[model samples]
Target chain A: METILKVKNLKKYFGRVKAIDGVSFEVEKGEILGFLGPNGAGKTTTIRCLLDFIRPSNGEIEIFGYSSRNPDFYKSRSKIGYLIAGSNLVEQWTGYDHLSYQEALHGESKIKNELIKKFSFDPKPKVKNLSTGNRQKLGLIMTLMSEPEFLVMDEPTASLDPILQEEFYKIIRKLSSEGVTVFMSSHNLAEVEKVCSKVAMIKSGKLITVQKISALEGKKIHSVKITFSEKVSKDLLVDKNTEIQEEIPNGFELSVKGEMDAFIKKIAKLKIESISIMQANLEEIFLEFYKK
Target chain B: MIAIIKRALRDRFIPFISYSIGGIVLVWMYIALLPSVQQSQVQLQDVMKAMPEGLMKALGVSGVNLASLEALLAMKQYNMIWPLLMIFFIVSFAGGMIAGEVENRTIEIVLSSAKSRAKIFFSKYLSGIIYLILFVVATTLCAIPMAKLYGYEYAAPNYYTLMYLSLCFGLAVYGLSILFSSLFSSRGKVYGISGILFVAMYVLFILVSLKDSLKNLQYISFFYYYNINDALIHNKIDGLSVFVFLSIGLIASLLALIIFLDRDFAV
Candidate 1:
């Protein structure tokens, strides 16, 4: 697959404070890459650098094969769509005014009406009068109206209701299927996991890891809790990858990584009353990364 | 670019029309009183002679013959009243040009488009120039028709010179305010800095005009370069003054664009 966005060794500093430290990642064509981080973890800073709104103190960003530092990089913006986290719309302007301005810049948006209907946004009221959720809906419609090749959003669904968030995910999925590259930052791990194919985790201005969602879910980390009728030696299930979370008189809560076959066989030799195995979800993996 | 300009002009439409009509009516009302003032020229001259030279200069009525309609209009309209009005409008309008957008976070929307920063700056700057021209033209050009309505012999060339000087002055004020606008994100900061700067310059101009020993420092004030008396009464357009105004305007505007292009919109 072709890479649509590339960030390498990116560092941004405000005075002596490093906002983004040696962060690097890539998004391939037609891929939905979710940028996951806590508040002030350099997600917005990285996005700003990617959009060339702010210059990086070190390293570089390349979008569509053009260096972001290039003076002509603005030419590539025509194919990019952006949605700021909050209501960045003009307070005095109606939704129609914003749409008309965008249409004037690019051609008329063919899917403008469809996105508005899907979001159930009313474009007649001035933005100042719109509620926060309605304002987010308008911003979402604006980002998707032009049908850009690459979409960069900052906390795109931070204010959307659950149903609207689900609808937004469907639109993102549909857009990705049509070969649109999406890179969005969100603290909502569930939202990211629902739509994004890959996730890049960032913490304290550093990238923890970037991996496929499926790969993260298939990490072979499982929580096993076994209640045996009789007391068993803790050494019986001894394995390098297995961690005993809790010790009881007749039970053990084990967190096993990788294969469970040997542990299952070992436990089978002993009498077991009840056994429960729960697979690790993305949230658990995210928490583990944060803990580290 | 045109759309951006249109949006800017549309946003400022109410203020533009209000100020234009206010300026025209103000000029016309001052002209309406001209005939009576001219009729009492001797009495006014006596009163001017009784006033101290320093006080007269401070009032912008000392250096010129008060008998002339142009001199009376310059003293009454352009001297303190009209400039105060123009400064208020320029500071409020140009202060919001760039800083207001950034403060409201609407600049991100504009920057998200394909246009370069230069294009956006010029588009908004161009809208301001349009308003400035309209204000200056409406206020200055009406003097000719207004004097004609009062049956006073007024020179058209004098008002034309006034228009030229006024445009340059407006541009200078606009440049100063916009430069501050580019540097600060808050419109209130822009207003405060530009307001204090203008007040200082006006005070300096008044001091130099009042005291001959302070004459050397007169050149520091834009008010000195304005030379409204020469433009109106003498029908003289000083090339140096024009150059200074245009230079300040161009340099400030250029610096504004440069700073705006390099500025990082934090969050």
Candidate 2:
């Protein structure tokens, strides 16, 4: 796949406070990169640098193969679409007026009506009167209207209702299938796990790890459920190969990593009534990464 | 760029009409009542003598030859209220241009469009210029019949110098305000800083005209170059004054565009 966006050693500092400290990542074409981080972890700041709205204190960026630091970068950036987190649109104008104003500059919107209907919305009401979900829907319409090839959204689903969130997932899935590149940040781990093929974990303004969900799934980690016929001491059950995940009544849920054959044989020798094994899910792996 | 102009024009339509009509009527009212005031010239002069010096100076009464229609108009409208009205309009427009979007968080939407920051800045500035030009033209045209009816003997204004100087003054004020707008995200701060600076500068001009000690500070105030009264009444172009205002305006505008190019929209 072609690299649609690349950031090398990106850094941003505000008066000695490092907002983004040497963060680096690359996003491939037709891929949805889920940027996951805790609040104030430089997600939005990094997005701003990518969009060229703010200059990075150091490092380089290339979007669609053009250096973002160049003077004429915006000539290429105009094709980018974005939905700002917690955007406060003009209150006096109707939703239609706002959309029309944006469309007038960006040209026609391909999915205007479809998205509007899907959201079950009319753009007639004053923006201030619209509920948060409706306002987010309006912003989504504006962002997706131009049918842009590259999209960067910050917390896109935070304000969306569950049904709209599902619809949003479907829309992004369809867009990605059509070869659009998306780089989005969100706190919704489930949504990210559902839609994003690769998740980039950010912590303290640094890129900690970037892993594919399927690749993480292939790790030799399994959830072992065992019901003991008699009480088993925690110290005896836990070895160098396995960690007790949770303690149940007369049972223990253990996470057995690779080379657990010896651990399993030892477990069978104990008072074990029945044992069940299941693959570790993405959520469990994500939690491990997130907590780190 | 086209979108910016289109939206700006649409938003300013009603305001343009209100200001243009308000200007015409105001100019006409002052011109229409000139003869009666002229008749009371002797009494007015006597009353002026008894008034406080500061009040008279604020009204620009000290420099005017009360016997002439041009001087009377200058004292009452041109030098005082006309510029005040223009400043009111330009101040609001400039203060709101960039900062208003930041305040309302609409800039992210606009910036995400195909246009660059420079294009957006220039588009909005161009719209303001077009409005200012059209406004000046409307008021100039509207004043013809009123001047003829009230003061047929009033000296003809130097149209060439007047238009250039007025535009330059408008540009200067608007440019300064835009500079302030570019520096801050809050529209209220823009309004507050620009408005206070405008008044403070004008007050400095008053001191230059009235106090010997403060006369040297005239070069710093925009009002010093905005001598529309002398330009119209005395036929004095004051090329230096025009250059000063135009230079300040152009420099300020350029600074604003450059600063905003990389300024982060924190929200």
Candidate 3:
């Protein structure tokens, strides 16, 4: 597989604050890599470094075989698109003016009209008068209109409503299908789980893990609740990776990690009234990481 | 490159027109009073002779005949008021080009394109130079046609000299503005630093005029080189003055471009 983006041991320091400390990651062609982190976890810093907006104090970033510091990196930039949270659009300019300006810069965008229609954005209003959601929509359109081969987005859907977010996800999925590589940082776990093929989680300026979505789900934690017509001891279903969270009047709320085969087998023998099992979402998995 | 320049000028279109119109009106108002001032030249000369020589020198009107239209315009218009307005226009124009973009965070969007930073930086600087050209032409050169309208046969060559001096002075200010804009992220900082520096230069020019000991220090001030009285009255263009202003402008603008190309945009 072609390595579309490669960042090795990237470090950015603002005085004593290490915004990103020795972080390394790669995204292949057509891969949608979700960068997940809490606020101040250096997600935006990494994105800025990748796009040459801010220089990393150490290490290197290469996109399409051009080091970020190389003059030729600008050639690669023509094929890349970026969006930041709460984009700074010119307040006095109408959406059309921005589109015209972008067109002037990157040439005519083939999907400009389609994206505008899909996002339901009016192109006549000045940026200052638009709602936050509408502004985000304009930003999204600006980033995607060029149909770039690579996208580096920082919380691209941050201000979108759920419906618009879903639409954005669909558009991203379509782009990915057409072999567009994407690296997006987002705190929305559901959005990542819905659209990303793999996830890179960072905490306190350090990347803790990068794994496939399936691998993440394989380690999913399950919350199980069982009710019994007759009282049963909590020790009955207790096993490795399974802990009793709380004991209720009739049963116990249990936390089960990893495979639940043994716990299910034990529950099948004695559940008299009702049993409920819930799979943990990515948020839960990340919360555990945060706790650690 | 053209797009960047176009957008910059478009963003500042309103201010550009306002300053040009304001300058025209101010010059026209001074011209309207020229006839009346000429009628009272004898009385004005008496008052000028009675005033302290240092004060008159500080005002750029020392030992000059008030009867000449050149002297009247130079003393009344070019001495302080026009230059102050010109500096204000250039500061705001050059300041907003880079530092303002960073402060408002629009630089991210501007840099989002594939254009090189050098292209963007020079485009903005060139646009400012372009504005400075138009500004000097409108404010200073327009005096000829304006004087013609008032039936005053002003010397065309002197006004042309004034235009050259004004353009060079403006380039120096624009250079300073761009330099400050490159170093600072905030537009207000650029305005403050550049403002204070030019104000200090003006004060230095005044102090040098008032005190002989400080006269040796006058060469350091840009206002010292902007000899409007000499340009208008003698119809002379000082080679040293032009060289100083142009060299500062070239060196400062080149420094600004170098700094902009190297410095990180943390914003």
Tell me how each candidate scores on DockQ against the true complex.
0.63, 0.58, 0.64
Q: What TM-score is obtained for chain B in each of the predicted models? A: 0.95, 0.90, 0.98
Candidate 3 lDDT over A1-292, as tens digits, reads: 9999998999999999999999998899999999999999999899888777788899989999989767767677798988744558888889999889888988898889988889889999899999999889988888888879999898988889999988989989999999999999999898899999999999888898888888888776998888899778877777778888898779889888877887777777884687789998778777767766
Q: Which ranges of candidate 3 are over 4 A from the true structure? A: A84-87, A224-278
Span of ten consecutive residues with least summed lDDT in model 1 chain B: B54-63
Best by DockQ: 3
lDDT of 2 by residue, B112-162 (tens): 776878888898888888888887766644555667775556655554456
Q: Enumerate residue pairs that collide in model 1.
A: none
- lDDT per model vs. reference: 0.87, 0.80, 0.88
Predicted structure with the largest lDDT when compared to the true one: 3
Error of 3 at B215 (Å): 2.7
Candidate 3 lDDT, B151-245, residue by residue in tens: 88789999989999999999989988999999989999999999999999999988888889888899999988999889998899899999999
Model 1: TM-score, first chain:
0.90
Q: Can you give the TM-score per candidate against the true fold?
A: 0.93, 0.90, 0.92
Compared with the true structure, what per-residue lDDT tens digits does model 1 show for residues B173-230?
Answer: 9998899988888899999999899899999988887789999988989888887788
Ranking by lDDT: 3, 1, 2
Candidate 2: list runs displaced more than 4 Å: A84-86, A219-259, A262-280, B51-58, B67-69, B139-141, B149-152, B158-161
Cα-based RMSD of candidate 2: 3.0
